[model samples]
Target: MNELLSSAIKALGEKFGGQVSEFRDEVTLLIPPDKVTAAATVLRDEFTFDMLSAETAVDYCPQTNPRFHMVYIFYSTTLKVYLTFRAHVNGDDPKIATMETVYPSANWREREIWDLFGIRFEGHSDMRRLLMPPNWEGHPLRKDYPLGYEEVQYSFNFDEIDVRKPKGVR
Candidate 1:
């Protein structure tokens, strides 16, 4: 597994100038957002990574360069190995070319990332909210978002609760 991963990383770095870094069994390649589609094509064609297992994102609002990162997990059925490709984009304008062309399953995954992390997938067939409501204000998964709670209406008397009621008392 490590041998195949190293070979794949070497090919990607040589072909697309990807910043290949490995941590344990996971090999991450930091590719440019604009080159994402092309890079994915190479991975699929040359590396035999035909299955796209998942597409997700991480919001690093305070990062040095690109504050937003999109992660694509792919599996090579022939090689029986896993590879993860990551592309970085500015959080102010988080955008990356969609890989839906190469992997049809990326459609919904990309939508989920956009809905939760505000990472925009350009050229996606159906870029819509996958989880959050259409009228939702902000991306909840973003790290910059406040970790606060909304006030809830209590149906029971709070004064009576001071009597040490059971936890599940309704």
Candidate 2:
């Protein structure tokens, strides 16, 4: 890690008592859902991580205790480095504090996560679907969501499957 990120990690550990882990040289601070907003605030106000580069969610289906991991990436223009942190949310009713207040750009990213992953963002100014229709039934990105995959047709089954597929004339 570079000097800036190293020092930022140290400061974060001291502030939040977060669990730090590394993957491919990238450091991630695993924080509880409750402290996520506070951590983001500190990262912005104190660490000079002025940009909320990205905010997204990951669903761990079939595991309920900590079902979702909300990932936030921050970039510091002054320091020229990136830092990532994640908040663990319960699967039963996954919810996390919003960072849009700290980083205005987070508004859309948070909405996307809420729309596709079914993760709620508390204190979000306007939480609504970004890509999906307003009345869409369920979050399509979740692992538990139906695949809706169709089988491919081969030469042997071409004639049989072709009859079921809609035909078009050009």
Q: What value does the lDDT take at residue 63 in candidate 2?
A: 89
TM-score of each: 0.82, 0.88
Question: Over the stretch 30-149, how does candidate 1's per-residue lDDT look in tens digits?
Answer: 887788899889888877899998888877777837887788999988888888888877867777888899999998998998898887788898989999889998888888788766
How much does each candidate deviate from the true structure in C-alpha RMSD? 5.2, 2.6
Error of 1 at 38 (Å): 0.7
Give Cα-based local distance difference scores for all models.
0.83, 0.87
- Candidate 1 Cα errors over 4 Å, as ranges: 1-4, 148-170
Please state the error at residue 163 of candidate 1 in Å.
20
lDDT of 1: 0.83
Candidate 2 lDDT, 66-95, residue by residue in tens: 998888988999988778898888998888
Clashes of each: 0, 0
Please give the TM-score that candidate 2 achieves against the real structure.
Answer: 0.88
